[model samples]
Target: MTSFPDPVVLRRGSADPQAPLVVLLHGRGADEASIIGLVDHLPTGPSYVAVRAPIAEGGGYAWFANRGIGRPVAASLAETMAWFETWLDGEYAGRRSVVLVGFSGGAAFAGGLLLAHPGRYAGAAVLHGTLPFDAGVPVTPGRLAGVPVFVAQGDADTVIPRELLDATWAYLTTDAGSLTTTWRDAGGHGVSSGALAALGKWVGER
Candidate 1:
């Protein structure tokens, strides 16, 4: 059985309770330690929090069932979303702004969190990921209405087809209109230095 602690807390960055919170979610098979390295690569102004998924995969962990080549399971997705909602409200009670950073499955979870809550996040950075298209999954217009989102995808991502990437881009950009999509010329399903550089710049500017 997969179990996440009550608080589900993991810290990086300087200890500053008043600092803006930036949550980083890692990809499949990678733990919190994987992407927490981005802390040194991000703007030093925010307090960084890297969270590991609750479920323990054979090699690493996963937010929920991948749901094959279609979409995530509605119930599982809802559970994950609710968990994040409760965590966000509880932990960031009166914080000024919250930034979300996710890669691969982490990106999916981060995107879902913003989609489910909308307008709550100050800004978001989605790396090598896409938004899921499901009937029950929330994608309210006002959710990400004016929120700045930085999306980076590799042109040759074998894991996620170009068609899926384009569809996700269209949905997010058209609906949110505040999304900035960057396409890298790299291959495979991983983050790139260029994407990291762009994310760093976007974090500083946002």
Candidate 2:
């Protein structure tokens, strides 16, 4: 497995190691600070940690190399996931439960992690983004059976290709056998207040 630097994380709300951990992953061209801000809108029970992506992109960072919006390079995704796992094992090896919340590119990364290690996270929220299709993670039927997933998307999102979004929905709801909560807004490629509220509620219930 490839090794990388420890992730730079922005933490908020609760420092108790035993408390549930909520990891927030930002989109392409964003850093940990960007997603950490969302903590203000999320539920308060769990501790939140926003992790910076390993690869340097335009002016910010990226989780992995991508061919296009919502499309990741298989090799790069695999390497990065391995790097992330190293950090996770070191910092949270025996944690009770961990949840992931991601947006845009980060959503795909979150999906990759959740799909690759179905037993790791308690739940995952994909906000206004597509899953990591063909990104070296197994997408076979029932891979995520019994997993709780929250999928929020913009009905008119043009940034993520329609086919990819449809595929993600189908995989999560059908192939993966995930217990999914879905929300679609009429906006473009951003999360709305309603979606945030719903995400908070969903995480609270987890």
Model 1 scores worst on lDDT over the 10 consecutive residues at: 1-10
Off by over 4 Å in 1: 1-4, 140-143, 179-183
Candidate 2 residue lDDT tens string, 110-179: 9999999999899999988888988789999999999999999888999899999989988887889999
**Residue by residue across 56-94, what tens digits does model 1's lDDT show?**
786887776767642566677677667766777887788
TM-scores of all candidate predictions against the true structure: 0.88, 0.96
Assess candidate 2 and give its lDDT: 0.90
Highest lDDT, which number?
2
Supply every candidate's count of residue pairs whose N, Cα or C atoms clash at under 3 angstroms. Answer: 1, 0
The Cα local distance difference test for each model comes to: 0.75, 0.90
RMSD of 2: 1.2
lDDT of model 1 at residue 171? 66
Clashing residue pairs, candidate 2?
none
